[model samples]
Target: MSEKATRNFIDAYEETRAALPGVGGWLARRRESALDSFRETGLPHRRLEDWKYTDLRQTLEKAAFAPAPAHEGAVVLPDRRSASAFAAIDRHVLIFVNGRYRVDLSQAARLPKGVELHALADVVHEQWAKDLVERRFDDTRQAENIVDLNTALMSDGACLRIRKGVKLDKPLHLLFFSADPGASHTRNLILLENEAEATILETHVGEVASFADVVTDVAIGDGARLNHVKLQDEASDAVHLATLRARLSADAKLSSFTLTLGCGVSRSQSFVLFSGEGAEANIDGAYALRNKQHADQFCVMDHAVPACTSHTLFKGVLDGESEGVFQGKVIVRPHAQKSDGRQMTHALLLSRDAAMNAKPELEIYADDVQCAHGSTVGELSKEAIFYLRSRGIPEAEARRLLVLAFLDEALDLTPHDLARDALKLLVSEWFGEAVL
Candidate 1:
C-alpha cells in the first residue's frame, strides 16, 4: 500500500524531471538517484521506529496530492498575524508562492560583500551547493531517508553562502506560501564559512489543502555562527514535512528554534553533527496546537568530537483533540571526551482529549562526558488557574496567561531578540483564537 502511494511521487518526478533545475547536469543525476532511493524506501510509516508516532506514509496516501500548479500573479499573503510575524523586523525577504520563487515579491538587494544568495536552480552547479546536498549523517538514516523525496521533487528554494569572516548586516527571511492545492517540495542550502555569522528567519503559512515538503542543509565552518528561527502555521487541512541537517566545524555555533502553530499533520526533523571540537549546538522549540492538529518533532544531536556541547528543549501546549509528539536523542562518541549533552521536553494538555508523547534518550560512550535527558507531560495547575480567577481575571484570560508563562522558558531560548518577541506574540494570538 505504501508503495502504491510512492508511485504518485515517482510519476510526478518522471513527468517534471526535464523542467526541474540542473537539467542534464550532476543535479539531474542526483535527482534520479534520489528518486530511486525513495522508490525503494517508500514513505516513512509508523512501522519505522523513528516514525512510530507520525505515519507519513499513511497520511500522504490519504491526501493523494498531485503536483502543485505553477502560481503567477500577485500573491495575497495570509491575513493572519502569524503569517507576517517578522514584518516589523529589518531584514532581506525572499518570497516563494506555491513553491516557486517570486523574484518580484522578494527584497534581497544589496547583500553583504561576501554574501552569495541565489535561487536553488542558479546555484545547483556550484561545488558548495553540491557538497551541502550530498553530505550524509549516518546516525539518523531512518529519520533522514524521507529527504530523498524532497530531493527528487524539490522545485525551488533559497541558496545562501556567507564567506569567511563576514557578518550579514541583517537577517535573511524565507517566506513560503502555498497558494495552490497540491504538493510542493523545497530544498534550502546554507553555508557559513569560517568565522562568518548570519541569522535566518523562515515562515510557512497557507490556507490551501496542500502538501509542503522542505529540506534544509547547513554547514557551519570553524568559529562560524548561524542562528535560525522557523514558524509553521499552515491550513488545518494541510500536511507539512520538514527536515534540517547541519554540520558544525571546530568552534562553530548553531542555534535553531521552531514554533509550530497550525497544519492538520506536521513532522519536523533536525539532525546536527559536531564534526569539530569546542563546537556548540542548541536546538529548542515551542508549539501550540488545537482542533485535530497533530505535530511530531524529532531531533538527533551527534557529538562526534570531543569538548563539544549540545542541548535540546521543547515545550508545547495542546488543546481540543490535538496531539503532540517529541523524540530526541543525544549521542556522545567514545572519543568525544568532555562532551556535554542534555535534552528535555515538557508539555501542557489544556483539554482532556489532548494527547502528548515524548521520548528523550542519550547514548554516551565517553567516560568523561556528561549527558542527561528527561520528559514531562501534564495539565495546567488547577490551583494556579483558580487563583487567577479569584483575582477577578477571566478564566479564559487566566488560562492564556498561564500558558504563556509555561511556554516562555522555551521561547526565551530563541537566539534572536526580535524574533523571540514575534514568536511570543504569535503564540499568544494563536491561544486566543483557539479559546474563542
Candidate 2:
C-alpha cells in the first residue's frame, strides 16, 4: 500500500512537472532531483529513528489523498474562531485557499521599503531564492525524505525578503485554509539580511479531510532577528506535516513558537543550525488534544560554531484516547566552545487511556559547552485537584484552571504579546468544549 502511494505521487509529479513554475530553469532541475530522492525513500516509518513514533508511510496509505485542485471563485472563511484567530491583529495578510494564493483575500499592498514580498513562482528565478532552496545541512537526508515530496509538488507559497538595516513595521500573516478533500504542498521562504528585523504569523485551518504538507525555510544574516509564531487548528480528519528549517549567522537571533489545537494526525519538525559565532535561537511550543487525535513534535538544534545558544521547551495535554510524542536533540560540536543548549518536554495526561512518549537527547563534543535535556510525563495532581474542589470550585472548572496553568509555562515563551494572549484564549475555549 505504501509503495502504491509512492508510485501515485511520482506519477503525479511526472504529469505536472512541465506545468509547474520555473520550468526550463534551475528550479525544474531541482524538482527532478527532489523527485529522485523521494522515490528512493517513499515515506518515513517506524524503522527510522527520527520517525520511530510517527509512521508517516502507514498514515499516508490510509488517507490516500490526491493532489488538491486549484480552487477558483470567492471563498467564505469558516465561521469558526480558529479561521479568524488573528483577524483582530492589524497586519499585512496573505491568504491561500486550497493551496493557491488568493489575491482577492489578501491585503499586502503597501509593504515597507526594502521589504520584497512575492509569490513563490515569481521569485523562483532569483539567485537568492535558489540558494535557499538548494542549501543542505545534514547527511541524514533520507530520514526527512517527506520534504522531497513537498519539493516535487509544491504549488504556491509566500516569499519574504528583508534588506539590511530595514525592519517591517507590522507583522506579516499567512493564513491557509483547506476547503477541499485533497493534498496541498506549500513552501515558504524568508530571508533577512544583516540588521533586518521582522515578525511573521502563520495560521492553518481546514474544513475537510485533507493533507497539508508545508515547508518553511528561513535564512537570517548576521545581526538580523526574526520572530515567528504558528497556529495549527485543522479539521479532525486532516493530516498535517510541517517542517521548519532555519540557519542563523553571526549574532543573529530567532524566536519561534507553535500552538497546536486540532487535527487527527499531525507532525511538526524543526531544524535549527548555528553556522556563525554568537547566534541564539529559542524554539518553544504547546499543544492540546482529545479524542483519538495524535500529535508529534520533533526538534534538532545544531551548534556548529562557537558561542551559540539554543533553548527548546514543549508542553502538551492529552485527553480521552489521544497520544502525544516529543523528540528533541541538541548537538554541540568539538570546537564550538561556549555553546549553551537546553531542551525540555512535559506532557499532562487527562485520561487513563491517554499516552505520552518523550525522548530528549544531547550530543556534546565540546568540553566547555553547557547542554542539558529532560522530559516529564504525568497526570494532573489529584491532591491539587482535590484542594481546588474543596474550595467550592466546580470539578470541571478546577480541571480547566489546572490544565491552563500546566500549559502557561510554555505559552510564556511566545515572543509576541498579542499572539500569546490569543493562543491562550484558544486553549481555554478548546478546554471548554472538551468537557474536561
Candidate 3:
C-alpha cells in the first residue's frame, strides 16, 4: 500500500512551489533535494529506534490535514492565557497569523545599530540566512526525517541576525497564532556574530484543530551568547511538530528552554553541535499535560571539539490518561577531550492511567571527558500532599501546591526572570483548570 500522507505532502509541494520563496535560486533547488529525501524516508514510525515511542507516520496519516489558508481579516488572539502570557514583558514583538507575518499586529522598533530582523521571504536571498538554512549537523538522520517535509513546505517565519559585539536592547518575541484549522509550515533563522548577545522568545497558540510544523536554525559565533525561551499551548485537537538546530563556535554560549502545556499530539526536537572549543550549551524544558494529550521531547547534543560543556534537563506532569516522553543523548567525540556533559529527565504522574517514558543516554569517546545521564518517573508524594493539607489548605489547593513545587525545580532553569514568572503563572492557571 502507498503512504497516503506522504503522497499528499509531495503533491502539495508541487502545487505551491511557484509561490514559495526563492523562485529559481538556491533555495528552490534545496527544496527539491529535501523533497527527494522525504520521498525516500517517508515519515518516522515505531520501526525507527529514535521514534520507538511516538509513531508520527501513523498519527499524520490519521489527521490527514491540508494546507492552511492565510488569515486575512482581523486576527483576534486566542482567549486562553497562553496567548498573552508574556504581554507585560518589555520587548520587541513579531506576530504571525496562520503562518503569515502580520506586521500591523507586531510592535518592533528602534533596533540596535547592528541588528537585523525580517520575515523569511524578505531575507531568503541573504547569504547569512542561506548558510544557516543549509548547514548540516552530525550523522543523526533518523531522528529528523520529518524535517525534510518542513524544508520543502515552510512558508513564513522570523529571521534575526545580530552583528559582532552588539547586544539587543530587549528580548525579541515571535508570537504565532493559528486562527483557523488546517496545516502550516514555518522556518526561523538566527545568526549571531562574534561577541554578539541577544535573547529571543517564541509563543505558539491555536484555537481550533490544526497542524503546525516549524524549524529553527541558529548559528552562534565565537564569544557570542544567545538565550531562547519558547511557550507552546495549542488547541486540544491540534498537532504540533517543531525542530531546532544550533551550531556554537569557540567560547559561545546557548541557553534554551521550552514549556509545553497544550496540544493533542506534539513533538519538540533539538539538535546542538559544539563546533569550537570552550563552547557551552544548556537545553532544558518543563511540561504539564492532561486529558488524552501526548507530548514528546527529544534532544541530542554533539561535542565535536575539546573543552566543550553541555547540559540537558526535562521535567513534566501527566494526568487524565495523558502520556509524556523524553529521549535525550549526549555525544563526546574522540578528540573532544575535557568535555563535560550531563543529562537528566524527571516526570510526575498525577493519575493512575498517566504514563511516562524516559531515555537518557551518554556516548563518550574521549578519555578525559566527564559525562552522566539519569531519569526518574514518580508520582506526587502523598506525604507531601498530606502535610500541605494539614496546614489548613483544602484538598484541591494542597494538590496544586505540591504540583507547583514539583515543577519549580525545572522552571527555575529558565534564563529570563520575567518570563519565568509568566510561565509559573500560566502553569498555575492550567492546574486550577485541571482541578475543575
Q: What TM-score, over all chains together, does every model reach?
A: 0.99, 0.98, 0.98
- Give one digit per residue, the lDDT tens place, for model 3 in 1-436: 1389898888889888899888898999999999998898898888777889887877888888888888888988889999999999999999999888999999997898999999999997899999987877754688445778888998999999999999999999999999989889999999999999999999999978899999999999999999999999999999999999999999999999999999999999999999999999999999999989999999999999999999999999999989999999999999999999999999999889999989898888889989999999998787987898888888888888888988999999898999999999999988999951
lDDT by residue (tens digit), candidate 2, 1-436: 3687798789878877776888898898889999998888788879888888888788888888888888887788777787787878888999998887898889999899999999899999888899888877793364458778888898889999999999999999999999889988999999999999999999999879999999988999999999999999998899999989999999999999999988989999989999999999999999999999999999899999999999999999999999999998899888999999999999999999999999999988899988899999998888999999999999989999999999999999988888888888888888989868
Give lDDT: candidate 3, residue 355.
97
* lDDT winner: 1
The C-alpha RMSD of each candidate to the native structure, in angstroms, is 1.0, 1.1, 1.1
- Model 3 misplacement above 4 A: none
Higher-ranked by TM-score: 1 or 3? 1
lDDT of 3 at 425: 94
Residues 68-179, candidate 1: write the lDDT tens digits.
9999887898889978899999999999988989999999999989999999999988999999888878996895558888888999999999999999999999999999
Return the candidate ranking by lDDT, descending: 1, 3, 2
TM-score of 1: 0.99
Model 1 clash pairs? none
Question: In candidate 3, which residue pairs clash?
Answer: none
Could you tell me the lDDT of residue 126 within candidate 2? Answer: 89
Candidate 1 colliding pairs, count: 0
